[model samples]
Target: MTIYCDESGGLNAGAMTFAAVMLSPQVAADIHARFRSVTGLRGELKGSRISLVERAYLLELFDRAGGRAWVAMARRDTIGGKPGGAVPSDLSVYAALLNLAVGRWLPETGGVCTDVVIDDGRYDPVILGKVREEIQAGLGAWGRASLAESHRSDGVQIADVIANSLFNIAAGSPRAHRIQRIIEPMLASKAIRVAELKDFG
Candidate 1:
């Protein structure tokens, strides 16, 4: 199995989300090609850049194509500390969420070798390495992980959609209701697992 991961929010006083989309490599490739052909999206399919309708269509395709996602969320009050004092870095919160999502999705025993692909955002190499270590540890030493630019990775783009959709739900955005309606099937079918982290301060 291959896991593609991305994050949304977490930069300031708002909800933060990390989402992982899992699928077999061949299936993922097929879906990516199909999605691009069907949607005719020329550039990177970023969640923020696409419309709600586009988002819905893309997510539905993921559901129909056997892609599964795990979303981990942390509200500002939970991971953010006192206003003036030492606050946890965004990378730390992101790492924690990654750990939670991967740990929940992968089985403890007899799990196949997994590869994790993350969006190469502004993450520092050292922090990313730590996150990789945490995820590998959770996957029992068989997991391999690497970073890629979202523009070049269709799987990571899917993860970006997952993270953004869940972030809207967690933050109670007006679009949450509609987005939830679209993703309800994924939740019902257990294709998506959600986690909300409490105060880590």
Candidate 2:
């Protein structure tokens, strides 16, 4: 099974989007449990907020998850703008990156996957559609893919908080925020940030 985590912006930046995708329920539960244990979390990891403990737990989870995990960034694409005018929103860009990550994880059989989940947030169906298209294209004609979106007021907040902390850990918080300005637009539309074992450049 493969689980992915990603982020849309950094701390230097004002806002960011992040997400996590897992194919196996057992693995997902184990990852969540490990993180909770590290953080000493007694309640649900729902909502949009995360504490320092939670952040630490996530780092540990990543370490155990292995390095092959995938990560993608929506940094300046050489033109200081979206790759193309058609994908103008941050959500679309995030979706595009998600597509790329999922593309990389497709099984050889090209079977359809439907256990996917996305956090609830501000975004348009149009951008989501584009992301869906990208995911399908990535799978080719062999396998199929499906999307599932859900709301957890707490999880959303937790995702944002954790994402910011991860960015800080990567570099300095100051730089992370600075990068946020440039990266937020790319992440604006994502349901949540995804995580991978590899570092982003």
- State residue 17's C-alpha deviation in candidate 1, in Å: 0.6
Residues 157-191 of candidate 1: C-alpha lDDT, one tens digit per residue: 88898899888887778888988898888898988
lDDT of 2 by residue, 107-185 (tens): 5224644333344244566655565566556656654444434332322223334444434534445445544444343
Q: After superposition, which runs of candidate 1 have C-alpha atoms over 4 Å from their true positions?
A: 11-13, 82-87
- lDDT agreement of model 2 with the native: 0.44
The residue pairs found clashing in candidate 1 are none
Q: Which regions of candidate 2 fall more than 4 Å away from where they truly are?
A: 2-6, 10-23, 37-48, 65-68, 76-79, 82-88, 107-120, 140-144, 150-201
Number of clashing residue pairs, candidate 2: 36
User: TM-score for each prediction?
Assistant: 0.88, 0.53
> How much is 99 displaced in model 2, in angstroms?
3.1
